[model samples]
Target: MQFSSIVGQGEIKQRLINTVKENRVSHAQLFLGPEGSGSLALAIAYAQYVSCEDKSDHDSCGVCASCRKYQKLVHPDLHFSYPFFAKHKDDTALSFIEQWRDAIIKHPYLSLDIWRGYLDAENKQANINIAECHQIIKKLSFKPFESAYKILILWLPEYLDKTGNALLKIIEEPQPNTLFLLVAQNQDQILNTILSRTQLVKIPCLNDNEVKQYLINEHHQTEHAAAEIAFLSDGNLTEALAMLNNDESSYHDYFLKWLRMCFSNKGLEIVDFVDVLAKLGRENQKNFMRYGISYIRECCMLLAGAGNLVHLPAKELDTAQKMISVMSLPMAAAISELLEKAHYHVERNANPKILFLDVSLQIVKILKFKTIPQGTHYIPN
Candidate 1:
C-alpha cells in the first residue's frame, strides 16, 4: 500500500518518510491506532518506502521492482503475521496467506470481523499461535534476499497472547537491516515484554471531513449521504465503508421513532418495534445501536447548550432539538449509557428482541418517568 493511496494522516506520512530520510528508523516500532485509522496501511507504505530501490522523499516509486512486489504483498523479504483461526495446530499464517493477501489488498482498513468472513471461522477465536511465533523467529533469522532490509509486518499483535514472548529475543536483537513493524489497536492487550521493546508511533483517528471526502471521491456517494455516514461512523472508515451497503438515514428515523415510543411508554408499539429490530441481523443491529449512541450523544450536546458543537444534519438536528425538550442532560446521558450497554451486549451475541425490549423499558424509566439514578442531578425548568 502506497502512502498516497491511504486516506488522511498527512503528518504521520511525513514523519514516517523522515525516518527513512534521516536513517533513524527504529528496528522494532509499533504502529498503534484504532481500526480504520490506516495504521496497517501506513506500516506497509513505510516498509515499501524503506525497501524501494528508487524512493523519492515522500513515497516509494510505484514502478520500481521492490514497489511492484510490495504492492502485491509477494516480496521475498517482506512477511506478514496476523490473527487467524488455525484449522490445525500446525496451520500457520502461510497456510492462509492467499486469503490474507486478497482480503487486505481489497480492504486495507480491515477489521477482525471482516477478516473473519474470509475464513471458515465458525465460532473459533482468532490468535497468533505458538507455531506462528516459531515460524516468525525462523523467518527473521534469514537475511534479505532481494531488498535492502527484511521486513515483517505483524498485524494485531494483541492476539499474540503468551506465545508472543518467544519472539522477544529477535525483536530486541534482530539481524542487521531487519525491521519489525507491529500494527495493533489495543496497547494494554499486548504482551508487556513486546510492548516495551518497540518505539510507539501514535496514529490519531480521521476527522469527519476526511471521511466525507473519501466517500465522495472514492465511493461515489452524494454529498448529503457522505456527510450523514461520516457523522454516524465517527472516524471509523471501516464502518463508514460497511455502512455504504446499509441505509443510515433509515436508522435515524427508526431510532427517533423508538425513542418516541419509549417516551410514551407504549407497550404494544415497543414490542412490535423490537420485532423489527430483531430482524435487522447482527451486523445491522449493532450498527443501529451505534447510530443511536451517536445520535443521543448529539442530543446530550444540545442539552448541555452546545448546539454549535453538534454535527447532525439539519433534519436530525431539528429532531434532536424536539427530543431534547423532554430530555434533561442527565436523562440524555442516562439514555446514552443504556444504548452503550445495549451495543456491548449486541456485540456479544445477546438476543436482540430481549435486549432491545430491556433497553426500551430503561429508556421509558428515564424519559417518561424522569427516574434517573441517584447522584445524577436533574434540573427542572
Candidate 2:
C-alpha cells in the first residue's frame, strides 16, 4: 500500500517516511492504535518505503519491482502475521497466508470479525498462535531476497499465546537487516517483554472532518449523506465503510421505521420488521444493533436535557423531535439499558430472531411503561 493513498494522519505518515529516509528504522516497532486508524496500512507503506529502490519525500515510487510486489502483498522480504481461524486444508496460519493476503487486498479496513467471517467460522475465535511465531523465526532466518530490508509485519500480537515466546529472542535480535513491525488495536494486551523490546508508535483515530472528506472523495457521496455518515461512524473507518457498502442505508431506514412504529404503538408491523431484518448480512445486522443501542442512549440523553449532545442528522430532526416527546425520560433510560444488554448478547452469537423478538417486545412494553414519581427510590440492599 502506498502512503499517499492512505486517508488522514498526514503527520504520522511523514514520521514513518522520515524514519526510513534517515535509516533510523527500529529493529522492532510496535504500532498501537484503535481500529480504522490505518495501523496495518501504515506498516505496509513503511515496509514498501524501506524496500523501495527509489523513495520520495511524500511516498515510495510505486513502479519499482519491490513496490509492485508489496502492492500485491507478494514481496518475499515483507511478511505478515495476523489472527486466523482454522478451515479446511487451512488448519494453520502458515497454510492460509495466501487467503489472508487476498482478504486484506480486498478490504484493508477489515477487522477481526471480518476475518472470521471470511473463514466461515461459526463462532470460533481468531488468534496468532505460537506455531505461527515459529514460522516467523524460520522465514526471517534467511537473507533479504533482493530488498534492502526483511520486514515482518505482525498484526495483532495480542493474539499470541504462551508459545509466542519462542520467537522472542529472534524479535529482540533479528538478522542484521530485518525489521519487525507489530500492529495492535489494544496495547494493554501485549506482553510486557514484547512491549519493552519494540519502539511504540501511536496512531490517532480519524476525526469527523477527515472521515467526511475521505468518504466524499473515495465513494463520491453527496455532501449531506457524507456528513451524516461521518457523524454516525464516530471516527471508525471500518464502520463507515461497512455502512456505505450496504447500499440500502439499512440502519437509517430501520431506525426511522422502528421508531415510528414504537411511538405510534403499531405492534402489527412486527412481521415486516422481522422480514427486513432477516435479509441483512451478519455484519450489517450487528451494525444495526450497535447503532440502535447508541441511538437509544442519545435519546435518553436528549430526554435528560442533553439535546445538544445528540448527533442526529439534519434530515432526522423531525423524527428525533417526535421520539423525544413520545419516549418518556424514564422509558428512554430503561430502553437504552435494555438495548445495551441486548447488544452484548448479540455479540456473543445469540439467535437473532429470538433476541430481536424479545427486544421488540420489551420496546413495546417500554413504550407504554409508566414512570415513577420524582425522587422515588427502591430498597434492595
Candidate 3:
C-alpha cells in the first residue's frame, strides 16, 4: 500500500515522509487507531518509501526492486508479528505468516477477528504470546538484507501477554537501520514499557466525504446511498465497505425492529428476537449490538430536536422520529447503556443468548421507569 494510494490522513503521511527527509526516523513508532483507519496501509507505505531507491516527494518509486518486494509483502527486511491461533499451546505467529501475508495482500482494512476466521478457529481466542518474542529477537538480530532500514510491523500489540514483554526491550532499541511499527487500536491496554518507547501516531477515522467517495468509486454505490451509509458508518471504513454489500444493513433493520419492540413492551416478540440473536456467530452478534447502540444514539438526537445531527437515511430518520415521539428520553438513555453492556460482554466471549435475553428484559423494564412530572409537588399520602 503506497502512501499516495491511501484514502485519507494526509497530515500523517506528510509527517512520516518528513521523518525520512530529516534523517531522524524513530527506531520505533506506534500507529494507533480503530480498525479501517488506514494505519497498516500507512505503515507499509512508509516502509516502502524508506526502502525505495528512487523515491519521489509524494510517494514511493513503485518500480524499484525493493518497492516491488514490499508491494507483494515479500520484502526481506519487512517482518510482521500479529495475533494468531495455534493448534495447541504451541501455536505462534510464525506458524501462519504465509496466510497472514495473503490475507493482508487482499484487504489491509480487516480486523483480527477476520484473520482468526481463516485459521479454522471456531470462536477460540488468539494472541501473540512470548514465544513469538524469541522469534522477533532472532529476526532483528540480522542486518537489513536489502533495504536501508529493516522494518518490523506488529499488528495488534494489545494481544501480547507477559511472555511478549521480553521482546519489548529490544524493540525499544533495535540495531541501527531498524524500525518497529506497532499497530494497535487500544493504547491503554498495552504495556507501559512498550508504550513509552515508541513515538505514538494517532490515526483518526475517515470523514463521511472520504468514505462516500471511496464507496462510489470502488463499490459502484449510488451517490445518495453512499452518502447515507458513510454517515451511519461513523468513520469506520471497514463497516462502510461492509454496508456496501447490503448484508450489514440487516443489522440496522434488526436494531430498528428491536427498538420499536422495546418501546411497545412486546414481551413475546422480543423473547423470540433474543433467541435468533443468540444463534448468530459471535462476530455477527457483536455487529448487531453495535448497530443497536448507533441507532439508539441517533434516536436520542431525534428526541432532542437534533435530527439534523443524525446520519440516517430520510426514511430511517422519519421512522425513528415517529418512534421517538412515543418513546421516553430517559428510557432511550437506559436502553443505550444496556446495549453497550451487551457489546462489552459479547467482546469478552459472554454467552450471547443469555446476554441478549437479559438486555431485552432490561429494555422492557426501562420502558416503565417513569420521570416525575415537571414542578409537581407531592405530599406523603
lDDT of 2 by residue, 1-381 (tens): 898888898999989888977878899999888988888888888889989988888899999998999999998898888888745422457687877888889878768877877677847767777667777888999999789789898989998877777878998888989999999998888888788899999999999999999999989999877877787777889888887876435566786687667656677787568667756656777788767766776777678888888877665555667777776777776767766777677667777777776777666666744432233331111
lDDT (10s digit) by residue, model 3, range 300-335: 988887877887767666777877776667667766
Candidate RMSDs in order? 2.6, 3.7, 3.7
Misplaced by over 4 Å in model 2 are 87-90, 247-249, 256-279, 297-301, 304-310, 328-334, 357-366, 370-381
Deviation from native of the Cα of residue 339 in model 3, angstroms: 1.5
Give candidate 1's root-mean-square deviation (CA, Å). 2.6
Off by over 4 Å in 3: 264-266, 368-381
Per-residue lDDT over 333-363 for candidate 1, one digit per residue giving the tens place of the 0 to 100 score: 8888888989888776687889999889888
Instruction: Evaluate residue 287 in candidate 2 and report its C-alpha lDDT on the 0 to 100 scale.
Output: 82
TM-score of each: 0.92, 0.86, 0.92
Provide the lDDT at 160 for model 3. 87
Residue pairs clashing, model 1? none
Model 2: pairs clashing at backbone N, Cα or C within 3 Å: none
